[model samples]
Target chain A: MKSDFYEFFCPVKVISGRQALSNLPHEMDQLNVKRALVVTDKGVAGAGLIRYVEDAFQGSACSIGHIFDETPPDSSNVVVNQVAELFKQKNCDCFVAVGGGSCIDTAKGANIVVTEQTDDLMKFRGAERLKKAMKPLLVVPTTAGTGSEVTLVAVISNVQAGVKMAFTSDRLYPNVAILDPKMTMTMPPKITAATGMDALTHAVEAYYCLQKNPISDSLAITAIKLAMGNLVKCVENGKDEDARLAMANSSLIAGIAFSNSMVGVVHALAHATGGVCHVPHGVANAILLPFGMENNLAKRAGEIGELAQYLCGREIPGDDRAKAEAAIQAVRDINKKLNQMSGLPNRLRDAGVTEDKLEAIAKVAVNDGALIYNPEEVTYEEALEILRRAF
Target chain B: MSQSSNKNDSRGLDSGGLAAAGASAASIYPKAKEPLGMNRLFSLSYPVKRGIARVALLALGAGFEYLSRHCDKLKEEISGWEEGRIFALSILSQGPSVTMKKENGAIRCVGEDLKNAEIVFYFKNIDSALMLFAGFIGAHTASAQHRTIVHGDIGIAMEALRAMNIVQSYLYPGLVLKKTFKRAPKMSFGEKILKAKLMLVLLPGIAAAARR
Candidate 1:
């Protein structure tokens, strides 16, 4: 059969340590750029991370354009266009994003306006649509997950259409991904857990993606191990730098895995929920994970059993049926610990999902592009069952 | 110690195997592997069964739950089967059987699983016998006797060659059997339906891989 896989990496220099924020200017100078545009939400802009970038660029060739700080939690196209207008007006040579997925995605969208000279997000919705590079984009995620800093995916929600338009292109990847745990130290435990679960879901889905190859499988396995070991610990103790750093690594690796292999029905369900009820993407995935894995388990018992062996860290002498269940139980154990530590809902009903909406949500999830790659066929009725279980 | 052929009467198995074994199997079908390839990977001795190729390729890693913890017998059954890790694995089979028509440099043979050769391995349960047939295909895939250009484009073919070399370096001696592609055995009604449904589940990956 023919293969349609394209692998590309964004060229970004990570200069991180205790004084990692101080390294940006020198790296920018080395890249030979004289001007920088600091893109972020007003909250982060007010926190003075932007000043660190400004102070570092004092004597170097780098200069800061006016900070575009009106970013929302879920940014809209208007905000992206507004930032792009500033990019052209200030003649900004590069972009420095000091926030989460939202800020970084805003910068990616704003870059399109600066170089591609168009604001149509629809034009670049599929693969390899943009053949050229955008201006140098730098992302420093304050949150430990959402590896937008290192990913080629730029997710933008078109609130008008109620669909999260996923704009994927190699050109959209940030040039530099600065992963400094200290940057994430200020996040609330809830925010940390939400993002961490998001990262964990990425790893889980990648491990099960039908297109997974040896390379992606290795990365997904490592990422999942990290998430299982550290996501909860970091959430419980916000000041623990080690756990924070581990989650950062987990998020980065999972991003790399899913970005290459794509995700499955968990993501398909999340996409539907996010589009319809405006649920946070990670929250939807967290609620559906065990259910989705169980449904896929009947047909894909072998792969699940292999994964179970890995999760158990040894071959447990038993029937394949028992082994597969053990692997899924491990996921539940992680979720249990995560909930105890982070305080997120264990079910959709707790997250405000109602039975009235289950059928519609399931129908939507069934049609999602991600469902086609699911380990098992999630017929329209099965999706509803998953929702009912979660609800 | 035994080259045994038990009736695969799924409806009756797991109970009184000795009494019910031969009644249905002997009259309805020929002996397995009359057209053998190798092992379950491919029994050239077995007649090319329906959709067997697709089931083997897609299910290369596809394992359903084991019915029992009795590993010794199962291992003995599959002991001769080639086992190794591969970079990327694919399976395809003929759709509903049809007359073969000569086309260009090759012949087009259509049937139950081959409806979509571009994504042949995506077919479902196909047949248990077919999985072994596909194993034979994978084993001989790089061998001279079964070597067919994996892809028409030079770059894709080169990639296949690279994968083949990697497989050779990392593979155990037993798994070399899958390289020789062969025809598979026929299937029961349940297996055929399962294979058809499973094919659609895998359809997305085909599109995704092609795009990549």
Candidate 2:
């Protein structure tokens, strides 16, 4: 459906396949990169997935200048500053972000600081603030989820301020995303299930959020179908290359979809919950997706109903309202199956959300920028109600 | 703002001499004779558009003052809000920002310069603001188009949006309200009297404020 006015853009050149990592050096040549800084977490390096990125650069003009593998699960501003300093010290011409969202976001934040020549990223926070073109960044996500390689926004936690600072600008989009299935093949069942569900949530929210338009709607539907078909198989059998590649594509497509259309209350609440209790982002989304949809059902029932068709692979038996309810049920069923198969958390309490912190989480959730894109207005009381229900 | 206006006036007129000459020779020039596209129409001398926006924001501020004083719904919605809570609605990098504050239990405009606004509603482009100021679209519709960004506490922003909706219900006609509001206000008999009373007080007050 067409809105009266809307804007959509995704400029990241995505290269996906079994041997896609081999194309990284050629892509680097396209970006005119020489020495590259490799950013990854200890977890990804431990899994030996960094080798795929390192090995891709062999026999090419571009070489890895330094490896900063200390990225935490939550990328922090302090870490970003350190990475930028290292990039400058090594005289690296580009960044090759490995691992998931945190590594990618750290590189993104560092890129802004390096190119803009600002020591404090706090001054350049918010949307469309960075005006200059950043150094070329090529992302090789070790996980199938987050899709951060293509996203134009980065969330880096400020350790001093105890807040997550989000940097959004067109300049943040990486020059290339090399999705090699081998990189994600090392993910365990639990991470696979959680990340898959996170991609599913992204597609679902993008399909029904206030910003939904024809282009995003089409991409979101395809992402939903791809994720629903491949997430379970990939979780059950991690070495299933086809399933891993499919889920990777789903995550990438869903990343593009939500990047343009944006997510709704689910992401808002999930972000707050993550900020408060340190829950992983994908697990929070996996826990809260259905509940978030239920909250918006009143205003977006017809749209939610349409998602049931994607999930069920057929027309659901009911009117728009009933189909919407069925869609909620379908999400619940998927959650249960994912939990049974891969031990993914199906409730907020299971995800370590304490009952006492619900009020605080609710207070913070209401302030998230994503709330502006929610289909229905969410008040504090309503946010608390959703938290309690999810709990 | 004035500095930017002077710069624009200089650039748009290509120095004062040509601008005066263009005004005099506007009828003879083919470029001047061309039908104005939407962008061209809005690209009127920046200072003039900026002036229109200032008046529109002031009028909107006065409208909020009336609604805050007379509308019981708005009062109830904003009840228990802090005394000095500030909000800013702006067109980013183009138009001026309008700041509003809660003073003496009602929201009123402070000035064009944004102070310590706890909440900010930003339009990414001036075209979005133009469409909205021209009443071609409503707040919810604008939001749907990804034309608005809320900075600061979103809960408080929603409350302010609700208050804006209440003000719109009273300020615009039923047809506009029907399109804009999810559930347009159905005023009771006493509420109708309150609306009438508020309008009687507002017209003179708005005129005075606009004049000043």
Candidate of highest DockQ: 2
Instruction: Judge the docking of candidate 1 as incorrect, acceptable, medium or high.
Output: incorrect
Candidate 2 C-alpha lDDT tens digits along A11-109: 999999989999988998898889999999999999998787788888998898999999988888899999999999999999999889999999999
Question: Which sections of candidate 2 miss by over 4 Å?
Answer: B1-52, B63-87, B92-96, B101-108, B114-120, B124-127, B134-136, B149-178, B182-212
Which candidate has the top score in lDDT? 2
Supply the global lDDT for candidate 2. 0.83
Docking class of 2: incorrect
Worst 10 residues of 1 chain A by lDDT: A1-10
Q: After superposing candidate 1 on the true structure, give the runs of residues whose Cα lies further than 4 Å from its correct spot.
A: A1-16, A46-48, A159-163, A309-319, B1-212
What are the lDDT figures for the candidates, one per model? 0.60, 0.83
Clashing pairs in 2: none
Candidate 2 DockQ vs. native: 0.14
